[model samples]
Target chain A: MEERISLSHGSGGKQTNNLINDLFIKYFNNEIISEMNDSAQISLDGSKRIAVTTDSFVVNPIFFNGGDIGKLAVCGTVNDLAMSGAKPLYLTSAFIIEEGFEIEKLEMIVKSMADAAEEAKIQIVAGDTKVVEKGGVDGVFINTSGIGTIYENTNIKAYNAMAGDVVIVNGTLGDHGMTIMCQRSGIDIEGELKSDCAPLNSLVDSMLEVCSDIHVLRDATRGGVAAVLNEIAEMSKVSIELDESSIPISEEVKGSCELLGLDPLYIANEGKLCCFVSEAYANQVLEAMKKHSLGANAAIIGRVIEQVPQKVYLKTIIGGKRIVDMPSGQQLPRIC
Target chain B: MEERISLSHGSGGKQTNNLINDLFIKYFNNEIISEMNDSAQISLDGSKRIAVTTDSFVVNPIFFNGGDIGKLAVCGTVNDLAMSGAKPLYLTSAFIIEEGFEIEKLEMIVKSMADAAEEAKIQIVAGDTKVVEKGGVDGVFINTSGIGTIYENTNIKAYNAMAGDVVIVNGTLGDHGMTIMCQRSGIDIEGELKSDCAPLNSLVDSMLEVCSDIHVLRDATRGGVAAVLNEIAEMSKVSIELDESSIPISEEVKGSCELLGLDPLYIANEGKLCCFVSEAYANQVLEAMKKHSLGANAAIIGRVIEQVPQKVYLKTIIGGKRIVDMPSGQQLPRIC
Candidate 1:
């Protein structure tokens, strides 16, 4: 482990994994916490199951193309709960704002958060606000924690993926990462390149309505699709072979990533999700996902295979295959 | 409202109230959210009542004399839920670390958090870590959100206080604020002045066992006893008369406050709490509190008076009466 924390420690990549396992897990060792999943599943009175998740959004330029920090904070937490197949019920937001920030901007950000909450059918039940002196912090940081109720029959988890399952993503990738990068760098592309930041609870509900036998459901947030698939492969002890030609990528985001010499698979996507479902329900789930606006670009990208256990492979359009390794270092910091 | 946010906006005083009311409440106006109390009261399945709370700890110098930021974070959120008469069940922690912070220090902090959770009989179920660039933030800031189950037949809220209720505070006041101030300012006193940051759930449970009719329970944290009493007075539409000589204050804290020309009432505390109960149950609750180690100095400092509505009065030792107003501006920032 590094002696001092670096930007990579928060990258949701290999270094972040090391920090969690080497330090966080070492000290916070417990049954539920050690699962190391996106959310913690807890049972109430040995009858009801609930999922809880937390995330802190320190995205630079609090305001971005699709949404602001507040909107991103709510969606991030809600999506985490949805990934666990829980219906997000309540959210708590804690904001740490630097002194001298514009009150109008704060109001706008909060309004955006309220709007997002309404769309997701979740309530911002509790909140705390702290203001620090100028230069003590950046513009603002929002931490949101959500609670959701998981139904009785849903058996969704990262470790639940099986060898014969099919993989599907709800929408396009790299839109959020590239948009934030473009906004921060003050660069403009020929067409509008907005973030794909949205809540996925509705889409998850639509899919579960058609088929609740999904093995794995994960939102490709910090590390994009590659990271999520790689983690699923490792956790479920299965191999994933992705068809590159079937992966959905917007033209604007693709052009932005190509111009910057970045791989779209490694970029972040806020309002997207990838699911592993039984082969019998893959087409039905994909069709259901495509019915929703947020999942209009739904596509089947890959399938779980038994050849390379605990690994992910990308079968390129050029008839070549390469390992889709977990992201290594900080590709882009503060890209919530 | 001011054009830009100032340090006073987060002071947990009058300015903080203004910011919350004029902005946060204006847009997030809802029945439950408009209450604007420490924690929000929420119901699940229309049968089970729960309390959810969130707090962000930006206490400077992350390490302090009695407790570090990690301990403060857990105790802060736990106390919030305890104030709502809830048995805290789970907590989620999100840490935002500066780029160059030492890994050893973070480990120590996480260890502190775990120890505090164990003591409070809660689990640190889920967590998120985000590392910002160097100079982007102070050493570390932790945001903890807690979920607690509110037992039946316990009606406790800020507005539940009545005119004839008695006010009781467990332990001494202002220890946390003074200790942090002394540590940050490099001033050492002759005797020890440690922070009173502690979990008050056990004490609360003891009191509840003795008397479930406790009207209001609140921890005197940021703006201390004065801020809490004033808010209760306004919320319940009642007046309070406090005997200055009856309030508990340690000798060292009194001396420090005298030397610094600061009112002990306006200072912060972590382990202390104040409750409002009918005069009938005050003695029983006080006896129960005194039985616990955390409430050895529990005392009846005041009672709800009918002289003035929506006001608070302090009767001095010299037999003079004066108004105890809400704190106006930021006396101490980042004191947890």
Candidate 2:
């Protein structure tokens, strides 16, 4: 590890994993965190199970094309719990605001959080506010911690991927990362490019109705689909093969990535998730997902394989095979 | 409200209350948050109740006299949960680090956090880390959210104070605020002065054993005992009378405050808590508190009165009385 913290340490890629494992886990070692799931599953009174997750949103632009920091804060944590097959019930929000920030803007962000919590059917029950002197922080940063109840007979985990499982993505990728990148760099695109930052608990509930035993469920946010796929592959010790033609990508995001010399596979998405389930239940889960408004573009883009264990391979439309490696450093900082 | 947020908005005094009520509670309006206890008490499965709380630490000079930001972050949230008469079970930590911050320093912070969590007997089950560009933030900030199971048959709240109840403080006051203020201003006090930052869950447990129905248990942080007493007075619709001579203030803290022309009442103490209990159990509670190391200097400082409802009065050593009004603005910022 480097002597000084770098932007890549928070990239949600290889460096982020190194920091979390080498520093955080080394000291705060415990069985629950050792599992390395999106949320930590704990049993209360040794019977009732609950999922807990926390995230701090430092998106550079407090407000963006489609959503603000507040909405992203709630949805990010809510989605983490949902990925663990939990029904998010309560959320606690804490804000660290820079001095001289506009009060009205703060109100707007709080209102957005309230509205997002309403959409997710969770309540923001406890909160704290801290104000620092000018320049102590960026405009403002919000941290949200969510509590959720795990569903019965449901065990969704990253290491649950099996050899005969199929990989499904709910929507197109790179919309969120590309939109923020363009907005920050003053890039004016001709097509629609807005963030896909919405709570996915309802969509997750719909898919679980079809099959409660989904093998792996993960949201591709900071490091994109490629990162999540590589993680699942390593954790489950199973190789994965992706079909490039089947992977969903929006036209605007594709154009933006091409123009900016970036890969859609490495770009971030907020309202997207990758699901792995047995091949027998793949179509049923996809059909259930497509019926929801947020999952209209759901597609089965990959499948688990036994060859070359713990690796992800991309099958190109040109009939070529390439390795999809975990990102080494950050491409976009504070994208989510 | 001011057009822009001032340091006072986070002072945990009058302005902080206004910001919370006018903005946060107005938008994030719910029955749980409206209770406005240190931690929100909610029932899980409509039977087993739990307490949840969140706090962000932005104290200047991360390393202070007796504790660092890491220890402060854990103790702050743990104390909040304990104040609600709950057994803290888990905590989630989120860090927002600035680019180029020292990794070694971060490790020390993490180690301190681990030690504090171990002392509180709580597991840090989930965490998130985010890094921003250099100058985007001061070195780093931490937000900790705690979850604790509410003890059965216990209902501690701010509005539970009765007219005959007595106010007791666990230990000396203003050590935390004065320590930070002196360190920032380069003041050298002759006597010992350091933050009393420690997890009080065990101490609270001891008191609960003596009387489960203890009323208005609160840690005197940010705005100190004066602010907390005023809040309880307003909430319970009763007057509180404090004997100036009985209030315990360390010799160092008293000298520092006098030298700096600051009032000890408005200063913060991280490890101190104010307890309100009926006169019947006050002696028993005090005896139990004194048995604990953290409460060796415990003293009964005041009592609730029907006169001057919704106010706090201080009785001087010379038999004079004065109003301990809720501070309007911040005397010290980022003292937590």
**Best prediction by lDDT:** 2
Each candidate's fnat, in order?
Answer: 0.80, 0.84
Per-residue error at B82 for model 2, in Å? 0.4
For B293-316, candidate 1 gives per-residue lDDT tens digits of 999999999999888446889999
lDDT of 2 by residue, A151-245 (tens): 99998999999989999999898889999999999999998899999999999999999899898999999989989999999899999999999
TM for every model, in the order presented, reads 0.99, 0.99
lDDT of 2 by residue, B1-336 (tens): 899999999999999999999999999999999999999987779888899999999999899989999999999999999999999999999999999999999999999999999999999999999999999999999999999999988889999998899999999999999999999999999987899999999999999999997988999998899899999999988999999999999999999999989889999999999999999999999999999999999999999987954689999999999999998776688887
TM-score of chain B of each: 0.99, 0.99
Model 2 residue B142 distance off true place after TM-score fit, in angstroms: 0.3
Candidate 2: misplaced stretches above 4 Å? none
Q: Name the candidate that leads on DockQ.
A: 2
lDDT of 2: 0.94
DockQ of each: 0.83, 0.90
